[model samples]
Target chain A: MDATTVTTWMREIETSVTQERDRLVQLDAAIGDGDHGTNMTRGFAAVVQALSQDQEAPPGRLLILAGRTLVSSVGGASGPLWGSALRSGGRVLGDQATFDGPQLVEVLAAALASVKDLGAASVGDKTMVDALEPAVAALGRTVGEGASLADALEAAAAAAEAGMRSTIPLQARKGRASYLGERSIGHQDPGATSTALMIRALQRAAAASS
Target chain B: MAIQTKPRKFLNDPADVVKESLAGLAAAHGDLLRYDRAAQIIVCKDAPRAGKVALVSGGGSGHEPLHGGFVGRGMLDAACPGEVFTSPVPDQMLAATKAVDGGAGVVHIVKNYTGDVLNFKMAAEDAADDGIRVASVVIDDDVAVQDSLYTAGRRGVGATVLAEKIAGAAAEKGASLDKVADTVKRVNERARSFGVALSSCVPPASGKPIFELPEGEIELGIGIHGEPGRRRAALGSASEVVDVMVEAVISDLKARAGSQVLAFVNGMGGTPQLELYLLYGEVDRKLRAAGVVPVRNLVGSYITSLEMAGASLTVLQLDDELTELWDAPVHTPALRWGV
Candidate 1:
């Protein structure tokens, strides 16, 4: 996608976080510090504001800028996890004016790898990786099968929804929620849920662009 | 479900809490510290002491007098305070690391939390990229939590106080970065802590107590960040609570008969000094009976959860060297002796 497309994706994330803030906060309150919603909302608002300052930035630079803003403003685990994820994705997409399904898959894979590295989390850890890993895999599968970017994103978003639901009964193994151990079970992981929202936002952005 | 109540705090606004508190600290200890308004770091007045190993430590902000309050002559060279109960960013840590590098290298004393460890790890990498040698030790001394095989290893709590003291002293003594990191790790290995909460704490951003505690109930093995502890039970007498805490810490520490210990009874911010002192007496009695003798002790609110009415017992298995480090001259706003 182009710079404008990337900016739209960020604005879409801001809207999603704003709309789902309380749900994410309530979920975190069940197992964490009760601020994932607020943190995401704050981080993305700054990302949108920052992107406005450099509207003509390349796709990679736009994402790196957004990631840096999240790292500075989020002030929680999400700061580094999502920050590094976007930064990694941007670095992989370097200098591309526009990319296709293969590049999107590569970007998602790089994001997942960065998040897993930064958070030391993998599938079933009940973190953002829970949703992100599945989304990346789904996007890769659809794209490898010659699907369009919009269709691949839609598949990834659906898989992320399923991954988000998967956290409902798993005990948290990372983040503030992990401190609760068994108490964290039965609660939807706030990070995973927000990540599902984020992936869906990407799907919508891709659909609109296509 | 029950209705939650807003916590009562004296603040001009929720967003300004950390900044305002840091400003007040700078105002109160101008000679000892310089607060960086833009970077939001607390640096000792005489930092970058040539030929000395610089010690840097930080985490979330709600734990007052922790990384910041202890920045002084024999303690930390700098501390990066994050939003309340949130880990500080790598940028802040980078600034602190750069500000305190003394050519001998720098040591980062990180608490073992996912956020704290991750951010510190990033900052350490960034600093290393900048060609500054950095050594880091993640203290995980809380017996209430498990190890790294499953969960993030034990949450680093009360022992951070002793670690900062020992590491700071070692750095001030011109020890190499390795020596300071080694000494701090030793203290972490020898220390164990257990905390209990009689009430919940509030994050100003939310304005409500993080969790609801019914009347006459207490949470045992609570996290310093207001995470409900291992178990909740009916509130018991001070002596009864201290007995449980002592037993858990001693058992986890493996402190046997004739073992000398430094006992630190830390209040969870809202608790008064009288209560902490009384609990220390109980801790002392129980430790003596358990054959773990307390040769030195500190009873006060040092590492705290904002306005949470509780206390934690930290017992450091002491040797002559550690005790010497503990008694080393220190001058800080929250701690001062032998100055």
Candidate 2:
């Protein structure tokens, strides 16, 4: 992906987070501190603003800047978790002006590892990892098969959506929702849902770029 | 049971609530502390003292007079307040850490919330990167839920006040950073808290109660932010609520007979002084009867959830060192006794 395409994806995520703010809020209210929506909205808005200021930056630098901005502006579990993910992914790209599908999967792998490391969550823990790991695995598999980037992202987004929906039935075993134990079982994880939104934004940006 | 149903708070703008409050705080207590508007930190006027380990603690903003009001002599060196229920950013924390670094080192007292833990983790790393010796003591001493190796574990509650006080005293007395951290860890290990909410709390941004609690029902085992709670149950008398809270706390703490304990009864914002005192009375009686001797007791709205009518009970089994630390003079805006 190119710098402009990455920037478009960030804006797309910001728009998606804004539109789904209340839903995320409601989901968090049931099992958490009820600020996930506001936090994501604020974080993505800052990401967009940061990307705009450094329009000449390469895709790698833009990703790093966006991650740093989120870490500084968001001020929540999501802030450091998402910030580190983006920064780690950006580091894999390493100021490269453009990268192909295989490198994109590497970026996804880097993000997944960052989040898992910081959050200490696994696939069944009902966190952002649920949506993220599956999407990354799907993207890795599809891209490895020599598929186009758009098709790979489409599969990734679909996998993320499925993962997002899957969270509805699982009990939260990490984050604030974990404190609720069984009560956290029925509610959709706000973090997972937001992850799905972000993955879809990547797909949309790639599709539009093509 | 007619009551005030109006949703109201004295705020100029929802966005500037924390900033405006800090402004007023600085104006009123300029002698003790200063509000760093640019960095969003509430710091002691006498910070960065050459020979003392500085203490820094903070979390969401609504828990007023908690991280902020406690910044003064013999207590916290700095407090970082975030927006409403959100945690303070790492940049803010890093600024506070750097501003208060006294060459002796710094200790961050973090409550065990995901956001607070995550943000402080970043700040601690950055501080170390900048060559500032820093350590963090994470407090998670709530008995309202079961804590396991997995999950976020228990929510930190009323005992945080005790940890801050005792740890701050240790830091002020020329103790090394490790010793002070150990002191705070002791408090965390011995302290257990349980809270109950009579009504839900409204965030300034949302302007509505975050959760629904029908009248005559109590959201027991609630956290400072009023997260749905451990569970909801029928409302009972103040004395009954105190019994439940005391029972849960002492049981979780496993306070054995003939052991001396420090009792603290805290208000959850909207609760009146009259009610808090009454609950303390019940707590005193209950503890004494159960052989958990109450030695030092504090009663007030120290840590709070804004406008949420409720109360929390915290018990700390005290030894001589902790007792001495607790009795140490602390001077601050909201809580100060001995000079």
What lDDT would each prediction earn against the true structure? 0.89, 0.90
lDDT of 2 at B238: 84
Question: Which regions of candidate 1 deviate over 4 angstroms?
Answer: B1-7
Give the per-residue lDDT of model 1 (tens digit) for A81-157: 89999999999888878878888889889999999877878898898899999999999999999987878898999
Give model 1's docking category: medium
Model 2 lDDT tens row, B1-339 = 235344587877777988999999999999999999999999899888987999999899998889899999989999999988889999999999998998999999999998899999999999999999998999998887789865688888887899999999998889999999899899999999999999878888766678888988998888898687778899999889988998899888987898999999999998999999999999999999888999999999999998889999999999999999999999999879899
For model 2, report the TM-score of its A chain: 0.98
True contacts kept of 1: 0.52
In candidate 2, which residue pairs get closer than 3 Å at backbone N, Cα or C atoms, i.e. clash? none
Tens digits of per-residue lDDT, candidate 2, A1-210, equal: 699888999999999999998788878888887888988998999999888889888998888999999999898799999999999999999978998889889988999999999999998899999999999999999998888888899999999999999999998889888877787888889999999999999999988988
lDDT of 1: 0.89
